[model samples]
Target: MTEDGGRRGRHETEEERADRMWGELIQEVRVAQTGVQILFGFLLTVVFQPKYDRLSHSDQVIYIVTVVLGACATGALVGPVSLHRLVSGFRVKPRAVRLASRMTFVGLLLLLATMTSALLLILRVATHAGFVPYLVAAVVAWYLLCWYALPLWARRRHPVRPGDRAPDLPPGGPGPGRRQGRT
Candidate 1:
């Protein structure tokens, strides 16, 4: 039971919750990091390619922008690891977790932009067709749907209610959102 009289949600302390969430966040970041690193590596090599010299000025600009976006995305994705390394043993895991989460979110947004720009540049160079923009738009829309919409929909559809215990937790454990009752 909480001071506010609401039922506790989990049995873990703040630090414990932070530890669990930090581990999960790192795992998620690892997946994103690998992808962004690969993309950024490929982007970096594009300027050295023989065909790069034949690209139109506009295409060159687009390629440059895509590379910059990729670099930014990579930095943002890797920021959490640095944050943890610097802040470890500071007794601020909870705050660090929150900050890391925000960094990861920003990284994901940057990654989306990076991918979209890269796709547009690729298709433009490959086809030079009038429909390239449309095709890129469609792909960006698909990414938004898959990456953002579905998760948001599920989160909205099934929210955690006050007093509702997490499934994995044993019953009657004192935790956040749990009501305290007379013994």
Candidate 2:
């Protein structure tokens, strides 16, 4: 019941944008929440195992830190659900979306830390060779490259200027499928 009677209407306002953004955020949260929950569940079971006791004090410390980070990540990632529950129908969706986006961003950072530390711990325990740290560092670099660096480089390098034309072709151009002929 909006301008276009659907999602293709006028530009969304801060409030409408918030509502829309919230829906998008919820979808995003579903993916991250599932992952964080699975990770947290797995982390919870490690304490009961026998090899867990054999871990060095340092490894144990890393495990504890990783678990804490994973727990925090889960909480922050799931914060949007609680936030939506608390703020739904309050007529302040714009602010809620912004807040939830921030929380989700923080949650992603926490998830990164949790995963990194978890990887470090697993690699350290599974292979006591001197090259474990190096291997972990390489993997971390690859993650950073794939997750952040490549996108950043693309964004910076292929930026659109203010006067740049869009990729739309005019009425009968060589766009989709059109061979020149009669009308």
Candidate 3:
């Protein structure tokens, strides 16, 4: 323990860091899971609407693809919970967390596709306007920017390196905690 009552900042045990990271990942996954489940539920009922029959064949195909994507998103977003349940107390959380995070990422991507397709189908049916494809493309671009680009940028900006390359530790100065023998 240091004077600040903090564990040495640069030296977190693997399990300790994993524990903290897992908490953050779980919170993120919970938000995504809730969204996908709700969207899937709403989608499941849309096909039964009387208006559904009025849709063109192409729009109906889009609807089916969108619904499938939503179902897949729900499965993937909820995968972490099932993974945890199945692997509880197995001492494999770091690997499990990595896999779960990948599942969540896939789920989010699927959710993005589902949303774009659903929006395209709905907009085409509601207005039959000429600009529907352009509109959908714009929305998808926005989602990519918001969900992927920004986070990727942030991650690139602030990377974690070992003590030598790490931000807080200055480069090549006899490493950390060298005492100068001055007169």
- The superposed Cα distance between candidate 2 and the true structure at residue 38, in angstroms, equals 1.0
lDDT of every model, 2 decimals: 0.80, 0.74, 0.75
Which candidate has the top score in lDDT? 1
Q: What's the CA error at residue 68 for candidate 3, in Å?
A: 0.4
Candidate no. 1 TM-score: 0.85
Off by over 4 Å in 3: 1-10, 164-183
Sorted on TM-score, highest at the top, how do the candidates line up?
A: 1, 3, 2
Q: Write the per-residue lDDT of candidate 1 for residues 1-183, one digit (tens) a residue.
A: 344644355656656767887898899999999999999999999999999999999999999998989989999999999999999999999788778877888899999999999999999988999999999999999999998788666655665553554433346443432212210
How high is each candidate's TM-score?
Answer: 0.85, 0.76, 0.82
By TM-score, how accurate is candidate 2? Answer: 0.76
- Residues 1-183, candidate 3: write the lDDT tens digits: 223544444455445655665787799988888888888899999999999998889999999999999999998988988998999889887678767867888888899998999899889998899999999999999999999778666555665433323222345422322211110
Top candidate (TM-score): 1
